[model samples]
Target: MAQPTAAESWSGGNEPMKAEYGKLMMWFFLVSDALTFTGFLTAYGFMRFGHEATWPIAEDVFTHFPGIEGDQPLLYVAFMTFVLIMSSVTMVIAVNAGHQLKKTAVAWWMIATIVGGFIFVGSQAWEWYHFIIGDKGGIELADGRVLKVAEAQTGEVLSLSQLVDGEAGHASNHLEKFSTGEVKTAFEANEGLVLQSPGKGHAQLTRTESLRLMQNAQVVQGANMKHNEYGQGQFANFFFFITGFHGFHVFSGVIFNIIIFYNVLLGTYERRKSYLMVEKVGLYWHFVDLVWVFVFTFFYLV
Candidate 1:
């Protein structure tokens, strides 16, 4: 048989899975990002389980709620998760509206999704603030163990400032200014306070032993790369790395949504006789929401 001409033999590349080029690229990006998140969560799981005896309890660590008098474990985190999930719902509606070529409906739904995104991002910021500032402070011993002050009888954790004479401001970094002598003085004056290690089965030390441990201890308030008032430093490190990374992705998605929303308002898709752009962005928004569900499970529920 005679060889076919090059032009006759040529055919456009296949559109695998019947996806448009842009949608396919987005899926590839999401898969890569998902792997990155999986690696991070896996590392966190190893560290937490390896030091199961000393790992901080999620409920105890995330007990703060805005404008609340006392600890409310995981309540605020649940709120954030709900908002993100609802945003995904709005994105679905927006995509459906685009499929029907209803420009006004698409615009309104896009706005709703954008609002939900803003709420979630703002809530995450509030959570980060509390995590970095800490609630009750602790003492880091020479061997890197952290011990919190609590009522000897009730075991209710107390802030270092509560034992001290003056009002301590809410500044997250203020505890760094307190001298060891000042901390020792506060500990001595509070007769009912004892040092307790954080963990599932950790024991509290007697007053005498706590005082002795204080002699070689450094005060730690809030969390940083080097010190954590909660428990092991690795917990804080992982918290910051994983959550901050996810937050960045959410922020980027919000910006992308905003651009799509503006285009929808301008009838750009209607003029093109296709709403493929809205569908593409919807895929991303849904992916972001799905990832948050896993994050919520790993960080809060697990």
Candidate 2:
């Protein structure tokens, strides 16, 4: 057999690694997207480690569950991670079915994958809702430190309404904000409540020190780009940006899966005698799932 001429090689007759153009392009896109996520997670790691002492603990911040009361740290997030991973598993099955030309199996597995994507996205939205709403209100000092009101004996963080005597009027941001005078007055009246530092160690102050700190503090409830009740403002900022970005990717993958699913039902691939489109979307889905593993580890587990 004669080797191909240089002209033939240059004319795109040679395929690198025996991959088709579409598969290679999908790989390229995934590589670029992986880099983008790496950059964001790297920035997050630097900031988090730089302020490790004062940074919010993932468990403490994500303690809420849908129907359960009290703190269930890491449980709900674990569920979300499990669902996403299962979706990736279903994608694998769908791809395998496509390879075998089993149309019915492919369609069913794709539906399962789509449902899993929807569940994960919905769960993330719920998580974000709780994060923005915040668990307990706190006071932000002039130096940007947050001091939470907690029971002196139990160390349980308390909301502003819990510290105040009566109904705290709702503010525009859905969190009740009180004037400095009102907060001071309420603090002076409560002997059991103490101001606690937002560190991992959660340092607390005596009654005298708490009162002095309350004098110049401002009430902060919930989280936004500028303020966070949990801890540092940057924590909230990164949470919103990184998670929202990932969620958007998942949402886009779902849309892609739906389009491909419809095509499968219409026998588009059957007529062509190829299920390459299903395999392509499966690659994207797996990439999204793999990225989430890293995000989950860095943001929640670690």
Candidate 3:
């Protein structure tokens, strides 16, 4: 091959940019990944805005968790968000160490990043557990009403009549029992309860609760706990599909990081005299984190 002249080197280089071709490819991949995330987020916004009246308020919907009593709105997700963000920081440190050719430093940061990723996944699983299996679901009634039990000063869920549809000298109506067994019962039937707002209100029960209510004579005879009190069926569907897909990407990224971490320990990149592998995987990992940020903001925050 012919050597390039100094003029060619300064102008249109016979050489590539300071970054290798692999790094450039990683950039392209990240841009495309960003667009994919944007599409998902835009679709979410469109659907949510499209049904603003009926959409769930994220905080009210996700307030409680197992083993911890009382309202802790968005608590689980907030922890997951912090974990993922810290993992991103560790990943940056690893990338910096790669640039400095410090293999052990890179491995240390990568291990920390992996630990953060695992913690994030664990948090997500716990959140899902609360969502899928641990909520105390409830019901609605006719005459534009719904009933939830509430905690009275005595430490018990007050009858619907006590909370909103107060019987005497009350501004707002306390929750009223659907006379003659009209409202469906919740899971455990006696788990601690709180009355969510009416059908027009934003709280939601899970699929199981929805189905259970559907089968009940009260709801079947005619109560409004029908298809989706928490969110539209389409909304729930998209939420699961999009978020679950993004989570799978995070899982894959963790695996990729593990492989790269092993290679770094084995001196593979050192033998090549290039740290491009670490850099490339780092780009992918950051893309995963970026997607989660949008997911957290759009789905849980706003």
Candidate 4:
């Protein structure tokens, strides 16, 4: 009973447990996924910079709109971006409500997030359809070059319908050799559409150049996995890969959100005395939204 023992530090409990085990694991997964995305974007950057010339113009390539006529420029993508951003905000509200143990608020915010995700996914699918269908069809030349039929003065690209007297569907194979009166007649009929060629970073053409190039050429239309009407095969390849990957992420996030939404509705979090799952999923949703912004800026806007 001599000297009183000095009190030791309280090291019995885990002090650094701000998040639960599942939530912490989710964070680790997200970090790894982010690295994967960074790698893909890096590869795309290398390809884009390496093949500076003949790269397709994003604006000219993605000019289609929904339920509206005429070229809407980047209107659709802009709307998608807005929707995704709003979803991120809703996720924030959801996580905040979860922190406060408010089941009703969390459910509503999660539903809003789910709705936004559905709209985004649907829009992307529609965009993919139009991309596959293509806008104004063009031909790929024998020399691995693309020739677009565009307005002589305005430099506006023309659809196959406009060029071939309202021919709706795609006409002629890319490899089929065709050079004679048909092209000449097309030239005569559509005086406005000149043979346009792609430049270093943009699609450029002149009436004189087009008139000369159309002399010996084959006819083709649209784009595919192997070919692109705009220019360079890489554009289509990258477009499909990156967008499809992001779409998959969105679809997965939507599924997770639906599960969480139902759980909230059923009072699962309340019974468990914790709503941390919502917060964890919200982290994932926020990460997805951030990735989309980077993709939009680099691939579309830039």
Candidate whose lDDT is highest? 2
Per-residue lDDT tens digits for candidate 3, residues 1-302, read: 57778887778745456677778888988898789878888887898777665555677557654466556888877878888989999999999988889888999999999998888777776665445432323343343233334432233323323322334211112122333242334323534443433223434444454444434322211112233334343455566667778888888889999999999999998888777798899888888888888888888887
Q: What's the lDDT of the predicted structure labeled candidate 4?
A: 0.78
**Candidate 2 displacement at residue 282 in angstroms:** 0.9
Candidate 2 residues lying further than 4 Å off, grouped into runs, are 1-11, 165-181
How well is each residue in 85-120 modelled by candidate 1, as lDDT tens digits? 899999999999898999999999999999999999
- Clash number for every model? 0, 0, 10, 0
Write down the TM-score of every candidate: 0.89, 0.90, 0.70, 0.84
Clashes of 4: 0
Clashing residue pairs, backbone N/CA/C < 3 A, model 2: none
* TM-score-better candidate, 3 vs 4: 4
Ranking by TM-score: 2, 1, 4, 3
Q: lDDT of all predictions, in order shown? A: 0.85, 0.86, 0.63, 0.78
Angstrom error of the Cα, residue 240, model 2: value is 0.4
Model 3: runs farther than 4 Å from truth?
1-17, 65-67, 138-229
